[model samples]
Target: MRRGRRKFDDDEADFVKRGRIEPALSEDPDLPETGDRWSTWDNALHGPDPLPEWVRTEHGAVDTELGMLKTGKEADVYLVRRAVPDTDKVSLLAAKRYRDGDHRLFHRDAGYLEGRRVRRSREMRAMTNRTAFGKELIAGQWAAAEFDALSRLWRVGQEGGTISVPYPVQLIGTELMLEFIGDHKTGEAAPRLAAVRTDREGLEDLWRQMTEALSVLARTQIAHGDLSPYNTLVHEGRLVIIDMPQIVDLIANPQGAEFMARDVRNVANWFTARGLRVDQDELIERLSYEAGLL
Candidate 1:
C-alpha cells in the first residue's frame, strides 16, 4: 500500500531524522496561505517568525498541529493538541504565531502604534525602514503586546468581572499559546459571532453579554480598539473576545476617544442590524464615561 506525507509537521528535517514522520497520516489538517507578508503572518520560513518547540517532553505526550483556524494580517491561529497517548491528561491549545519577513502587505501599523514607544533610535529607524530586524521586532512587539493585554484582562476577569477570554497559556517570542474555547474532546472550534445567524433571543443575549464585557474594558480604562463581531466568539451562550494585539491605551493614547467611539459603534451597528434596538449614542456616551474619556 502506498502512503502520503505527514501534513502540518513543524519541521521536515527534525521529524525525518528522528523517525517522527508518519507515512500513513494523510488526513492532516488544512491550512491555506492567507497572503500575509513575511514579517507578520505564520509559516514563513527563513522569516522572522519564531519556531514552536515542545515545552514538555513526556514519553508519550506529543503535541500536534491540527490545522489553521484563521489567518489575519498580522498572524495566524492554528489548533494544537497536547495529550499523552495512553493517559487522560490532554488539552487543546490555540497557537497564534505572528508573521514576519519580506515587505508586508498592511500599512496601518502606525495608526495602532501611535501611543506605543520604541526605546532605541536604531530599532525605531529600522522599524520605519521595515528592515528584516525591524519586521522581526514588530512581530515580537505585537505578540508580546497581546500576551500582556490578555494576561491583565484574563486575571481581572478571573478575579471578579468575569471577562470571557481564552486563558493565555505561555508565550515564546512571536507565538502565543492560548486555551482553546471549544469542545475539549471533539476539538471543534467555536464559530465567531459574525458567522452565526441569530434570532432576536440570541441577539439580545449576545448584546447583553457583550455590553457587560465591554463595560469591564471601559471601567478598566482600555478599549478593544478593533472590536467587531468577527473577533468575538459566542460559545455556549457566552461571548468571548479574542485578538487583543491592538488593544488601545485609554489614557495614554491621544485618539483614545475616537477609538473607543469606533469600537462602540461597531458593536452597536451589528446589534442593530440583527433587529435589536440598541442605543448607539447613549451606549457610546456611557462607555466613554466608564473609559474616562470624558
Candidate 2:
C-alpha cells in the first residue's frame, strides 16, 4: 500500500553508475527469465493507498502479457497478468501505452492542449509546431494527464460512493497500468455503454449515474471533454467513465463551456432517444453554474 516514487538500491545504483545496466529482462523478445519482463513496480510511480489487495507489488513479480484488450487512436490497452513466480498472487492490469513519434495521431490534440503548458519555451515551440519530438512530448503529457485526472477522480469516487473508475495502479513514462475493469477469471472486459442493450429501468438508472458523475466533475471545475456512451462502461449495472486524456479545466480553458455543453448534449441525446426525458439545456445550465462558468 506504499505510495510515491521508489528509489533504486545502492547495489543497483552502483551497477547503473558502472554503465553495466542493460536492457530490461522483460524487453527481450525471447521471453527472458519467466514473464515478458520483471515487475516495473521497482522504479515506476506507484498509485495512491490503500492499494487493492490484488496489486502485486513485490520485486519478484513478473508481467505476462495476456493479450490486447482495446486499441484506439492514441493508445492501446493490453491485458497483463503480474504474478510472483511460484506463487498464486496475481493481478490483471490494463496496460495503456500511448503511441509515440510518427506512429501517433494528433488530430484532436491541439484543442485539448489549450490550457495546459510546458516548462520550457523550446518544448512549447515544438509542441506548437507539431515536430517529431514535440509529438512524443505531447504523447507523454496525455498519458500523465490521464493518470493525474484518474487518480484525483478515483479518490473522489472512492469517497463519494457514487462514481466509479478503474484504480490507477501505476504510471511509467507513457505507459499507464490500471486495475482491469472486467472478469479477471475469464479476461472478458465489461461492455461499453454504447454496446449495452438495457431495459427502460436500466436506462434510467444509467442516466441517473451519468448525471451524477457529470455533476461531480462540474463541481470540481473539470469536464470529460470527449465523453460519450462509447467511452463509458456498464459493469453490473454500474456506470464507469474512462478515456479522460482530454479532460478540460472548466475555468482555465476559454472553450471549456463549449466542451462541457457538448459532453452533456452527446449523452443527453442518447438517453432522450432511448425514451428517457433528459433536458440537455437544463443539465448544461446546471453544470455550467456548478462549474462557475455561468
RMSD of each: 11.1, 11.4
Can you write out model 1's per-residue Cα lDDT over 1-294, one digit (the tens) per residue?
889753322211111121122221123244223211111122211111122242223434555666666556677677776665666656677878777755334457776776777999999988788789988888788888888788778777777855788777667677787878877766667777777787888888888888888889899888888888778887888889998888888888888788888988888888888788988889889988888777
How many clashing residue pairs, candidate 2?
2
Candidates in order have lDDT scores of: 0.70, 0.82
> What lDDT tens digits, residue by residue, belong to model 2 across residues 146-228?
99888888899989967788889999998999988888888778887777888999999999999999999999899999898
TM-score of 1: 0.77
Q: Estimate each model's TM-score.
A: 0.77, 0.89
lDDT of 1 at 271: 83
Question: lDDT, candidate 2, residue 31?
Answer: 53
